[model samples]
Target: MATRLELALLSARGVGKGIRLLEYVGLVIVLAATLLAGGHEVWRMFSSGKVGISDLLLLFMYLEMVSMVETYWRMGKLPVRMPLYIAMVGIARHLMADSSYHDPWLMIAGAGAIVLLAVGVFIVRYGHLRFPYTQASEEATDRE
Candidate 1:
């Protein structure tokens, strides 16, 4: 039984190592892709001579995505609000860029959705700051 437990522990450690390796590889790939995409967008912005607020907003979204990836790589976790904030920016950009092409009602609905998502992100961020969670290792011991 002890040998079996040892083997299981070894397997778990091996799997954890494998996962960490894979995560690092994935992070590298994502970072490279993000840089390439950002460069392309900047080139387009300079060449087109038609950059607008929406273009800037899209760039901000890309920046946020890269930041989120870096944050996860550094901390092994991502803030839940990051992606939500990105999504809100993306939706706002889409609406601003193509508002005239869609029905007014649809535009209103999309804007409303963006507002709701932004509010949710704000609430989550506030809650997290106000009431941070205890680390799992810290929780293992009771305070005197």
Candidate 2:
């Protein structure tokens, strides 16, 4: 027979396992979707016989998504900058594909957003380098 504390710990462990399982399932779904989208994009380009810059950028975004998922799956952690990089790519793609040249303010806003995201990525990388996380904190962060 286990003590109350032991039972509680066991329950917590089970919950943790369930959460991790869900995480894995979610990752798989995301990976599958990304791959499917990328393949469709490639097929579209081949069928049309024209690969535009926007199409390439869209593919690149898919690749980044795949890489982000892979990194998280393998490392059990995610760098904060990965999503920022993806966002920057997405914004650039949008700006290129649907250039709002007539609306100079909108174009400026999109460019500003990319610049802000880049700055965020730089700050995160710099922080990780200058004030690296300790083993314990990193593990804590992974748990969260």
- Per-model TM values vs. the true structure: 0.85, 0.93
Candidate 2, 76-103: lDDT as tens digits: 7788898898899888888887856438
lDDT (Cα atoms) of all candidates against the true structure: 0.86, 0.90
RMSD, candidate 2, Å: 1.5
Q: Which candidate gets the maximum lDDT versus the true structure?
A: 2
Looking at model 1, residue 46 earns an lDDT score of: 94
lDDT of 1 by residue, 1-144 (tens): 469889998998898889889998998898888889888999999999888998899889889988998999998777899989998988888888885738888898888998899899889989989987778644663221
> Could you tell me the lDDT of residue 86 within candidate 2?
84
- Model number with the top TM-score: 2
Q: Which pairs clash (backbone N, Cα, C closer than 3 Å) in model 2?
A: none
